[model samples]
Target: MNIQTTLKLCSVAALAVALSACVRVSTDSGDNAAAQADAAAETLQDAAAGAEPADAFLARLARHCGQAFEGRIIANEPRSPEPHAFEGKTLVMHVRGCDDPTRELRVPFHVGDNHSRTWILTRTDSGLRLKHDHRLEDGSDDPTTMYGGDTATAGTAQRQEFPVDQASIDTFNARDGLSVSVTNVWAMEIDPGQRFLYELSRPQDDLNPQGRLFQVEFDLTRPVDLPPTPWGY
Candidate 1:
């Protein structure tokens, strides 16, 4: 090759090397920035988990969203017809519709052939709130619906307690005439990738001095197939 041609080739090779180096530097900067940003986010989440118990609990439950688990009544007291209704029937709870931005979650509880109950959890300014949304098979709201409560204490990441609030008591007495439920206290426990438990009890009083207790537990180790659309969505 001629001298000029060799000089041209060398210039082109130098330019190519410079360009490659520039590209590598750019890529390394971007990757480093992304990794640093991810680390910052994780740190913030960890701090939040330590500061807020409700947020931590909700985060754990959100992990199970879009999954359904089978459950059975583990404990019951003050024998009644309601317990019999769940006997010999498939019980399922489907965690669905997690809106983290809005801090709301909807979990549908299906008892055998009934798909009328959906448990709604919302992150209120004060604390966490639980409301029962019951609907008819045709998707109409039940008159005796929306009877749950807010968290009274800072529960653990795996467990939350909800004692019936005055609003729930008023609603129950007015709508269903069930004045005895004014002292109801409900609880939910979650063992991520293991189990979930729901419990209800009433404090001792003149109306319900014996104190009612009902509990149902779900196996979360294995997720079942999605069931039919819950009534009223």
Candidate 2:
């Protein structure tokens, strides 16, 4: 989805569901060289778990086993604001088990470039979280990733744990910056049949003298899916 570049370019903001901060994100020189190692170990673990064993990306897509749904990017800015490169996209989501109280893949997203990172999401009454199914080219433990989003500042996000909430599902949408006068997210859906929508909006007080803000929606669909995880682990 190229969102890795988008996320890398702009920081994620708290949806006001929680008082969060920035997540410090980093990577090592031996990127793909290590991915393969992690995959092998994970593959073996999957076989032991009795969960479906999937590789490449078909396996990941299998997890999403429900009807197609739409996703809209609601803007955190004025109504007539500029166009977001990744705005207005619908994703067919296969929320395997949102009915589960403790965990749910109600929402999932493609991490960086297509086939790179796969994220599973879970939501609770108080807040939400996620699991980062990370791996290297050779199935090895990847460099420990630390992500902390910004609560209300610049270049200051919480470390990528959530270590508190790390290893959970909502890591992909975690924030590392404050919601500015303009706030919004570039929403994308993995399901191929869904339609693109946008929930554009701006904060009440931040409105201009006209007592209004600029927000808009458009369509840009590129059907995509998650990469397979050998195990649900």
What is the lDDT of every predicted structure here? 0.83, 0.33
Residue by residue across 1-233, what tens digits does model 2's lDDT show?
59797775555343322333212112333444244344455445555665421121222323334433334444434344675544543323323443552444433332222222334543333233334444454555334332221112110011111222322214323433322322322112221122223222233455334333332222213234433432222
Measure candidate 1: CA RMSD: 13.9
lDDT of 1 by residue, 1-233 (tens): 99999999999999999999878767755645554454456446747657577876787678789899999998888787664677888999999877662499899999988999999999988779999999999999988888999998888766889999888888877854588888988999976666799999987789887778989999887799887888887
Q: What TM-score does candidate 2 reach?
A: 0.27
Q: In model 2, which regions exceed 4 Å deviation?
A: 1-65, 72-77, 88-90, 97-102, 109-202, 206-233
Cα deviation in Å at residue 166, candidate 2?
15
Candidate with best lDDT: 1
How does each model score on TM-score? 0.76, 0.27
Clashes counted in candidate 1 amount to 0
